[model samples]
Target chain A: MPDERSADEHLLAERLIQALNLEHLAVGELSPTAALFGHESGGLGLDSIDALEIALMVQKHYGVTLRSEDPDTIAALTSLRSLSAYVLAQRKQ
Target chain B: MPDRAHVINLCAGRLAFMLGFVAAGLRGQTTLLPHSLAARQLEAIRAAYPDCHVLDDSCKSDLQWQDSPRNASLDVDEQATAAILFTSGSTGVPQPHPCTWGSLAALGRLDAQRLTGSRQMNLVVTVPSQHMYGLQTSVLLQLFGDCSVHDGKPFFPADVAAALRAVPAPRALITTPHHLRSCLDAGVALPPLDMVLSATAPLAAELAEKAELLWQTTLLEIYGSTEAGTIGTRRTTSGEPWQLLPGARLDCTADGAVYHASHLPAPLALTDVLDPVSSGSFRLVGRAADQVKIAGKRASLAELNRLLLQVPGVIDGVVFVPENGSRTAALVVAPHLAAAQIVGELAQSMDPAFLPRPVVLLERLPRNELGKLTHTALQEAIR
Candidate 1:
């Protein structure tokens, strides 16, 4: 049986990569609960500008406005996995 | 606290509330917020320093605010900025400018008259009153320029329209190049004006030309800094001489960057790169050391780095313009990102001329022991 969660995660990773122009970040490298939101940017080795660009892209693509009001933006943006999940949910709405 | 003096910032409408405390002569931390909320910062003091003798517009009720005289005399001191004025530092660290009573008054009366002829000129500024440019044009210039001012932060095209409606015709719009571009981009119908003043960054002749066609008015570009206040004003498209404001004179250094101030004081060294216009006026080429002229456009390496770091996938980026016939090359560090993807995103907001022509990507950017980029590291990156 196909796992519903895996399908959702793959879809999200693909969407983020395209939207942010991160043509190189393959999907399998990202863990669903990975630390995508906080400051490991220098330590864990991710581009900071890429993160902001992704956030802007998410805001523009999703009808949902990302602002201080939304608590989930920070958590969801922490990693490709989490962002995918949050975006999947936003797509439904 | 004896350490800080209480101030009312009377020009701002919301700031008047603090007047009750400042008028009472209370000495406490008069933390002035950034110019965006100059009025509210003073108003908060009304409640914060009720016991002290304070004064400002916040003290009056809205209905009665009109009747209240805007004038309030302040004792001038060298450390006056420690009490009254505040500004944006751009860098994370923001510092206050020392505005003595004499300096503020000089800025209001003499400075305004010297820059744009006629005392009591109608004033219009989108720059926040908290900023030096905004404060000078809107408030200080009101008292000194002998002019009436229109209050409100005109940010969007709609906001500019509303602000114009509030002020009568024959007004001057004091604004920055950044915001002005956005207004022009919006393609909104604009009011005719006597003049427009551009500051904060160099006003491109192309932008000045666009503004002239749009509004049918002269757009005067100002060249100076927060520390020096506004010293020189020029009409870029008009190719007019940069008229030095009163109490300002120029002294060229070995490098040719102008040093300016009043005759009473020694001329202060300026970072502005200039071409002397007659004896008094000059043209601002760009900041001497921090920028490189690419295709006749001055590009600040610092501002570029700041923008590059903000890109979604860019962990870090550093640019170096080699002196070898102005080779515009930039090196970016993308530990987890691809070089091609990141550079494509950055080129959007940045001017095409300033954008790195041949952007180089690296795994890690080299930095000195002090965490600063050295010339050697820059050369290595370029190679």
Candidate 2:
């Protein structure tokens, strides 16, 4: 199968796995398009605590701050692909 | 709305929750507040209270407001049940404790005396109104005490900051240790606040000191539970013992400690171990056996182990909190199922916060000739 994840998505996935201490999961197993929050989303099933950790990780790595009140931030957090795009877009500015 | 004995309040907005609660009270209907809004948990609650109405944000559209006479005196029955809050008991079933209107009013008054002290403060609360802590600080305080609440439950650090900024001066932040830690770690610039209140989990002195220094506000940690509302308060940075609220007393017994208050209908036995420092002050030692708190939510280790063993192809398993560890760890002897697979199945019934991390799979659990799993043996297996 072709590698569907972009380079930035792969790097973000690595950081997420490490930051969340998800030793059970590997970088390649994380789907770039999968939902990252809800339990029924058939994704990593991360919760609010995991979201905070991701925000901290993003701030440290890309200098992008994810605010909870922002509608764009909420939309970006829906999936790994969206989060990667949001981070790249923020860094460009 | 059809006549019902109770209303299951699942409203996400604070205003909706308060309105539904007061409307139910006016109709002599009790409001049920479940610990979580998870589908399975709500289903269990609905099964128990089959006749209760489920009130949610969608019901807001159905609300028709009518202006009442100005300064009309609203009479409330003191003995009527106001709300029933659920706590996840050790048996894996949620136990409900009913709070009367009188008791809730007393608790709100006491909380105000200790927390706000006659100040008409605006609160930005991060916890849900369904929980006891949230209900006391956000809803009851606003209704009975001198305070108003922001309508939203802000989750993220930046969101909390924004909410606080939106509120007027003399603002307070009502949150848990988990959210407080996240807010501090995110390093979001927060507006100046009069006070910050924390509960649900024990706040570390260091964290409290840091919060006080950064926010330049007094940080108070409340000690209470679902059964007893706002039993005591402590300035976390002072490292002092908890001062019991007026008219509240703690008595140590052979079985366990029991809390007593004039407002409570009966003396309630406490699940937490307390160290009595004085007649009016005590220090919390820890929770009783089988109860573990993870990220401000309580679950039973025994219940977790039962769920783990109930998984298909699971032979034997034990869920335990490792010494000095906050999260639960599990050792399972299931050859057919992988660790992640077991966790995935467990997640169906358990909250994600209570899910065991680092589930270790072993061929067999170390047991003695007496068929007992000792601490030393379990530690060796995990190691």
Please list the C-alpha lDDT of all candidates, in the order they appear: 0.57, 0.83
Where is model 1 chain B poorest over a 10-residue stretch in terms of lDDT?
B86-95
Evaluated with lDDT, which candidate comes out highest? 2
Write the residue-wise lDDT of candidate 1 on B303-357 in tens digits.
7777778888777777667644233566777766665566556654454344453
RMSD of 1: 10.2
Most TM-score-accurate candidate: 2
TM-score of 1: 0.58
Looking at model 1, residue B235 earns an lDDT score of: 76
Chain A TM-score, candidate 1? 0.59
Look at candidate 2 and tell me the lDDT of residue B50: 94
Q: Where does model 1 exceed 4 Å of error?
A: A1-93, B1-4, B7-91, B119-121, B255-260, B263-266, B291-330, B334-383
DockQ of candidate 2 (2 decimals): 0.54
